[model samples]
Target chain A: MSVLEGINSKALKTGDLPPPSPSPNTFRIYSMRFCPAAQRALIYASVKKIPSEVININLQQKPDWYFTKNYKGQVPTLEHAEGKKLVIESAVIPEYLDDIFPETKILPSDPYEKVQQKLLLERLSDQLTPAFGRVFRAIKNPEELKEKFESILKAFEEAESLLEGAFYSGTSSPGFVDYLIYPSFQRVYWLTFLLEIFPLPSDNFPGPGYPKLSQWFKAITAIPEVAAASQSTENGVGSCKEYMKGLPYFDYGL
Target chain B: MSVLEGINSKALKTGDLPPPSPSPNTFRIYSMRFCPAAQRALIYASVKKIPSEVININLQQKPDWYFTKNYKGQVPTLEHAEGKKLVIESAVIPEYLDDIFPETKILPSDPYEKVQQKLLLERLSDQLTPAFGRVFRAIKNPEELKEKFESILKAFEEAESLLEGAFYSGTSSPGFVDYLIYPSFQRVYWLTFLLEIFPLPSDNFPGPGYPKLSQWFKAITAIPEVAAASQSTENGVGSCKEYMKGLPYFDYGL
Candidate 1:
């Protein structure tokens, strides 16, 4: 197998902090390979081709120092520059990167559009993310499971109406809103492959259920950087199995 | 008693929709005078002196049209010029106003500072809001209530560390961040008045216990517009009594 496929960098656990930022210019992301929120910043960084380095954290067994930087110790934190100024929160991480690197803009310059885009992300965070989570808990109860699926469908139905172009921002490119919400759908689609291991209902799956969302999903997957940044379903299945077994490993069941 | 204190401008309930936008420049806010999230946008707009009219919504009995504007039917939705562009979400409402009315800026101009300000707001939302909510639920349980109070304290301790100047942005003046978080503390402080009515443990009150937070709270309350925009604790007590009875009224014990 190619080394690229074989490369599954182990997550740094307690007492395993990554080396400091290479320089003031290069920012470091405290990320988890399988974490949806962490992948948000990763995809945004990759799409922008920002000078960034990744330090995958063992979210389960976080180092004490991690709390010093972020008391919550959530993944997708950004540390950069001479002061090593930290930016925590998934939404703000890429935002901070976008702020520092204004040349190739992913966020719309028009103020109304930008704030509206943020509103869209807020709606997704409120509705879609929870709807997706309910699916996992409702697996055994077929009716509740189906209801959760439809709820996710309804959120998409609204998105379908609002989606003017290929992406949320406009027709041409995926912007910050796309990246913010991308992880949720990406995780769902990848989880479909783990049906044998986890038994997520195949029939309940709402695939390309909405045309615009279909296009959006396909277009996002085609983005080379986003594709690289996202974990493969194989890796996903393996890590998920490990995560379920009380020991998560980023590598594909190594 | 003064006639001004009697004014609550009754909340528009089911089928009591407000009139159409008077002009392109004029804006409308769907608010609940007692709602903290709604108050966030209200304070921000007032502080910025944005030309806006408020139409308080009886959130418990929301008008159907409100859902058409915002599916979530959350209060503090901003309606503005031309297309009657709707800006939903408390944080986004002020941001939208800030964008449209840039002459009087509440948000920081610096990109890094702006994002950092947002991050601080995110932290408060994560920690303080829920902690306050827990206090309400844990009212009957002393141990749980005390733990919840400490959680609020810890969150404040972190805020104390970050708060150097008068506000989160700097020492000079309160900005968007201050407005964003103002409602939470405001609601908490106002809720204290209702303690006698609700039977919340009087001895457990961590009233301005922290020096920095005390100063920040005092400074936020000093802002003329912010003070004017917020509901009186008397009004809050009345609303809470009404809300507890399953019929909330904006008026102060009318």
Candidate 2:
């Protein structure tokens, strides 16, 4: 499959792969195309209009230096000012970006509301993301798939209850919570599409049960910055299919 | 077993169980005595001298209303201003407390340092805490315990390297990262003591493999606030014994 829109497809398999072309003073984000965690950072940077170079990494075949950069070897590792400082972990990176670009505030001004937004993201990452992963792993098992899907629905319902306004930020503008969740839901959209091709006993996707969550999703996706920053749904489905085949998944061919 | 000091021993099994005597306008934290996650919040509040009432819950027999408060029914759920606002998740709660009480800043002033602190906590929560849990669950299986312990050691090594100064915050006082990790380590300390009574091959705890981490741990524990907030080592071991016996753990006899 060819590289999709907004997706970086460079493949660097050897230790000798040269460091990304320097952006000098600008921040750089080490990312993988299809990684939801990495996408959160990327979307935040884009939404905040922060000038950052998104350096795509082939996680499966990372270079030796990548480990030195982030010992965990995970994506969304932000290299600040050409490696003067580096930060890892998806949750930390986005918040860091918000702090550096306070003018374009992704987090809320009110401390209480800000904490509430963070709590929602924390719940999603801790509960929903793992359940989403299980759905892919249990593709062949109807019982397991159904159970995982139900778990995802429960998370969505909780999220729906949390949403009070147009966005999770309670503003029209997409914020930290929106970026935190959108990528995972995007993957779910792709999973639903793929499930149609490869049917299961309980293959039905969890339709939007909560009106607020449904409206919030629509509002966030409608934003130009979010739309431009997201990877294609088609590519996500393809990667998931490869993952199910026990192949090297997440390899979006450059 | 009688409840230990600083531990709440009240048991409430249903919705009909009365809410604890109201603190009215003051802040309240719904917590369990031996919960490391809850301890993190309590220790943070203590370190900052945040005036909040700690409402101890018998988690094994939670009141029905507690679920309404925090759907997860987890401890360390902070009810801000007598439930005007609520925040759950150990990670989120401490950070929330830190934000509201910025006078005693647990998070760093510098953006880069702040992110690093968060990343360290993120790594500990994601990697070390689970390994620590497995060590408890795999107590009967020496090989699994050994494997889990080794994984934990790797995390410690990484953490040790992150410690350039006295504390993870690179300051004299324990901060966000310290509060985040100390409780888990306290649990580990008890686990090690219990393991001594119930020995296994490779039974030796990861005895401060890195000099910096050893020094860091010593420095943090030495702080007055930290010492005041921590549960007794004896209580932790007793709790772990009950945990291993497949009985309800965290019953720190007040």
Candidate 3:
């Protein structure tokens, strides 16, 4: 992913985030380097080998043009270079990308199986992601943390049952479900290492149960595309610790 | 939409909700008649003219089997009769149905345009829907209510800017964006009539600046499919009043 001109990829501060430029025919992704959601789009692009410009933005102090491009000013906003059409929302952008670039299909070909993958994505979004967020926000009391942990575990168990083959896509290649859940899992792994709050089961530390999900995590992280898009654990932990302190931290600036 | 055999379309109560039946060849939608989210699925089915058995379930007293089907026990769960494959989440099911039955497409043919519609849907989901929910939960203080109302209007204004034609879909017929947003707008209309907490803009009362959105709403509600799927203002208001009072109100049971 090529970094845009005039925007220092390594010096993105709160007020230093550059505005969106007129890209008439170059696909650009407006993102923050460390945001899990942004990483989702990046990982997808990496896996598909779709070359595009990636413009890292500071979420805390967004440029005026950023809000103009997207009312919510959220990251993972895809700018279609040709028409300058912008698509926001983490859930929508990835699917939109897959649809436009049929060369590498992120979604399953079988409609039923695709529906199942979408269902699994929905479960992670609704159940696990929020629990994961609560842990990262570091606002949960002990009892609340316990409840959240239980919910996260339940989500993991459900995911374990959903895995029919080596991958959630039921193929050798990772698809929509894999990309959808991997970012959050990656973040949680970092959180567990840094904070020691809720020890989520992973290949590194396989908890008593959830064998399938643990193995699946190992398989996903081992993918060359995923490995290329991933941030170093030290960098991830540093940024997360800063985030926990309510500091504005962007990995690209680190 | 055919009603399930054992489940009474009327007289559905907490304790009276039936368990999932062994239907091997009939698509089933487990829904609460008055739920806007469920209504979204129903309206999609109506527009597509897909024949499916609609099972009205008492949300407050969901059967144990329902939890087994969907862990969250949320309504608008689509059960594929053949494989017993369950698809939950309001966003996923409608799209799944459209994908399976390609006779009528809810999304646009142009990939970029579909991306735009999805973005609009995301705006509704993130901004307007939550604001509408806050009004219904009826727990916000006066200041918070005012703030939420302002945010809701902001969402409307942004939506107005997004409108390129008579519909958000940029065509004569209502599409994914239309179906996604209309249910929340319909519910807000009812809330305004019943609670009078936040008088949201509609075609009849067009609030000051959102001319496009107001006109779009008028067009959408005028469609035969939407009209058929909608509840009357009297019925909607009555249901809202009952909901506010903690009473069980299902249109099927009424």
Candidate 4:
């Protein structure tokens, strides 16, 4: 299935009020182009074929009115029911979307099987996301970078053990577990590029350490929606570098 | 519906395996008698009428093989599919149970409504649970206790604002949000008794501050499953004080 690029993918920022929200019925995803968390929702929406608008808000220069709608100011916030209600968090939005649009049925229909996927997703979130956070935080403090990188590698190994198939869904195709954690994997893969911007150590991505996860990452990235939702490694690094510098850097994709 | 009490509610210590998992089809919950997180799962199971065995393992002295099943060693680890699969996490277990057993559906089935309940539950976990943790940690440090108490009250206020009805499910009865968070609220409510043991200052559970939550707590506590699942205030305080002393204190329910 071809991934549906949303109604608007423009990098909307500061003054932007979200492209009229597409329609009264249509939901707008508050997003930033380079945000990995928001990208998870974007990819999930694409997979489910949710007809929505993407308002790429500026992280550094967030608009005044955006906070009125989502006070926490987190992305992947779903404004639905004509703004009477909102749903935030990457995992909750997709589960809600899966319910509204059941045709593709990436989430298993059977009671037991669906939960295995949720469990796998939870395990992945626990094992990988925290390690990724540590790596990002350790970038400026080069002393902690190596230890944090090792933790991420160990996390990758944990991820690899959870997979007996091409994906954590225990099937050939990508599922909830795959879509949600792909953003983290892509970031880690792109972090190999970090040597270019900030450097004090050797890039030791040991081939023997994460053979399964490396293979899985290569496989899932080729899928249509993943391609659509993912920003280039170049864009990721450029925006991320500026973001680390505390500068407004939204146009990294170009 | 009356809550179905589990087969064995005994405080089984280190060397104890679960009693026969009720039958082959039945699941077992790894729980600590005094744990609030485990109580969330236990109440959920009871509400869903899941006839399972509860193995209340000593949290301080977890058995050797327990880690083999759940290396994280967190309470509320569910062993199911004949022990071939395990589901951990308080929220995920209930979600899985809700899927398998469709009766007495505390979780909303509507895609949108279910998602709202999930969001409310998530928000409650965010606002209240952490404050409860802070209070627990502040027990030894008398200086931090007042600040932590105020934070918990603020969290309680945040919880009050989320309710427009007697419950978060927008209905007359308790739902997902109510049950998941009740464990934390009960803990905080019981924390008011900390002045007796911890040498804390005045117990200021102001009447007007959390009028809605205070009322809601009273109403929800009357529900059968909540009653079946909760420990008494004296027991809770006894267990918690011993627990704070950091000795092996599992039998405080007596």
Query: What DockQ results do all the predictions give, each relative to the true complex?
Result: 0.65, 0.74, 0.65, 0.70
lDDT of 1 at B3: 13
Q: Which stretches of candidate 1 lie over 4 Å from their true place?
A: A1-8, A137-150, A153-161, A196-208, B1-7, B138-158, B196-208
Q: Pick the candidate with the highest TM-score.
A: 4
Best candidate, lDDT:
4
lDDT of each: 0.71, 0.71, 0.71, 0.74
Q: For residue B193, give model 3's deviation from the true position in Å.
A: 2.9
Worst 10 residues of 2 chain B by lDDT: B197-206
Off by over 4 Å in 4: A1-19, A196-208, B1-10, B17-22, B196-206
Residue A224 in candidate 3, Cα distance off native in Å: 1.4
Instruction: Indicate the residue-level lDDT of B209 in model 3.
Output: 69
What does candidate 3 score on TM? 0.86
Runs off by more than 4 Å, candidate 2:
A1-9, A140-148, A157-162, A197-212, A242-254, B1-16, B20-25, B140-148, B152-155, B197-210, B245-251
User: Model 1 Cα RMSD, Å?
Assistant: 4.2
- Where is the poorest 10-residue window by lDDT in model 1 chain B? B197-206
